[model samples]
Target: MKGLILAAGRGSRLLPISATRPKHTLPVGGVPIIMRAVQALREAGIDDIGIVTSASSEAALRDVTLGSGHLTFIRQAEALGTGDATLCARTFLEGQPTLLYLGDNLFGDSLRPVMDALDGADAVIGVKRVPNPQAYGVAVVEGGLLRRLVEKPRTPESDLAACGVFAFQPRVLDDVADLPPSTRGEIEFPEALTAILARGGRVRALEFTGFWSDAGTPRDLLDTNAYFLAELRPRVQGQVVNSQVTGTVVVEPGAVVENCTLTGPVWIGPHARVSGSAVGPFVSIGAHSHVSGASIRDSLVDAFTRVQSPERALSRAVVGRHALIGPPGEEGLQLVVGDRSVVRL
Candidate 1:
């Protein structure tokens, strides 16, 4: 069995942050989403893995997966649909069963259950019962088999939402080649699977009840960061001075915290400095970042970011890498930030 990760998407929704790097490179809990996806596959005992990347991300993807001796990179020529991206790995797949994991998605549970259920199945898609099914690819299941797959159906027929994790047989490539373009003019992977379903292929379903995030937008990314951060084991290796740190927080080496209050499920990357601030409760401060005179919670401050907003509390925010977001000079400034709104100040 082989593991294939689709990481070629441009990630337009996650702009500014993803503008310089590939979507798959976005970090959650200080680990790249693509890397975590690869780790998940490895944990499931599928060591032979191939990553589908675009030209823009090919080099970085290789660099990120370098230490993994068994990982291979497959370049996708165009920004086609998921089907096209997976199709690029056809040669590498070589008729072996493959697990197609979406790059942006982070699943809390292991894929071993799905792999175990693929003993004689044509395909098995990981599904979760979500409150809002309209935003996901809804799967219609009957008698433990996939009846049909709908792409964001207006009125969802079932609560089973496709979590972008799929196991496909060798014949899946033929179906992908024969698929018609979706409304967006790209060969949709689901449409390709429709052909396989019509031919009586035995596609099964595996239900996942734990946390899952498809970090498409900024808010989604922030939420995912918090979710995964909470699951991490707490550790502190940095220099703490007159600071109060509590509960499941990871402070890597070279980090310095002075006169600050930090509450965990949080991650402070290496070389980061937090002074005269309160950071905590599901927050991630990237490498080399400086947080001074600020109160941040449930937020993600990217690498090299400098945030010094002591007056106004920062919550549910995403500060892009190298960004300088803070209150204006001369003080006495009042700002009202809206929820889910992006601000450059």
Candidate 2:
């Protein structure tokens, strides 16, 4: 089966970081967010992947998917809603059954169950019970079928929020073709789902008990790193020396560390170097990044970034690629830097 990954959003909530790179390219657990999505699809026996992206992010997507032959990239000229982004790939889908994933969501369970469920269903969407359903697109399920879907209803009838993983037969494209723009001037996917349901299409909701996180904002990104680390740390390999690592911590191969304290639920990417730094308890250091003479807690540092001497960063901050930080003279505590930015904190 083919897969479609929607990664076209500008991620305004993420601000400076999203200004330079797409949200899908943000690092989680030392890997790009979209890479996790791709691996999940591949594990589900769906190697053929199509990514919907805006023109600004086309190059980044290509760079990330390099050497993955089963991947295809489609450009969505306008930043339309989810429906319009999916419609951009209608020609590529070509009447084939496909899996759809939101680029920002990190999944813990294998997607095979949803793939298997598509045998008898026209569409299958992954759902999870959220504490507050009013903030999400919720599904009302009766028996095993989805009775109704409300897009961010003020008073949700159910707590089963759509987890953004979907399986749809090609015919669903017809429902999206004539969709008018939503209030935000983008084609909304929930409307397409509603249309399909109205046409007597079999839309099934699969409740997932396993871990899933939507990293839409800075806080969500940090929380996702913590969640995945807690669940998948033992399986990852890395050397721990002179550090206190609790929960799930993944240190990739070829990473160097010395005179540093590392708390659990952290990930240090391949070839990363950390020296005289204190990190952890919800932190992710990207590939080839360097942190020296710094103390960072609860932050995501992107690839090739350098946190220079005497800097201290704390709580829900994202540092982008190729960033440089000079010495900090005990002045500030929080720093959020974008890609290719240089700052003397």
Best by lDDT: 1
In angstroms, the error of model 2 at 42 is: 0.7
**Model 1, range 24-53, lDDT digits (tens) per residue?**
887898888888999999999999999988
- C-alpha lDDT score of every prediction, in listed order: 0.86, 0.82
Task: Report model 2's TM-score to 2 decimal places.
Answer: 0.88
Give the poorly placed runs of model 2, Cα more than 4 Å off. 232-249, 311-313, 325-345
Candidate 2 structure quality by residue, lDDT tens digits, 105-200: 888889999988888888888999999899899999998788899889998999999998988888888888877888788788767778888888
Cα TM-score per model:
0.94, 0.88
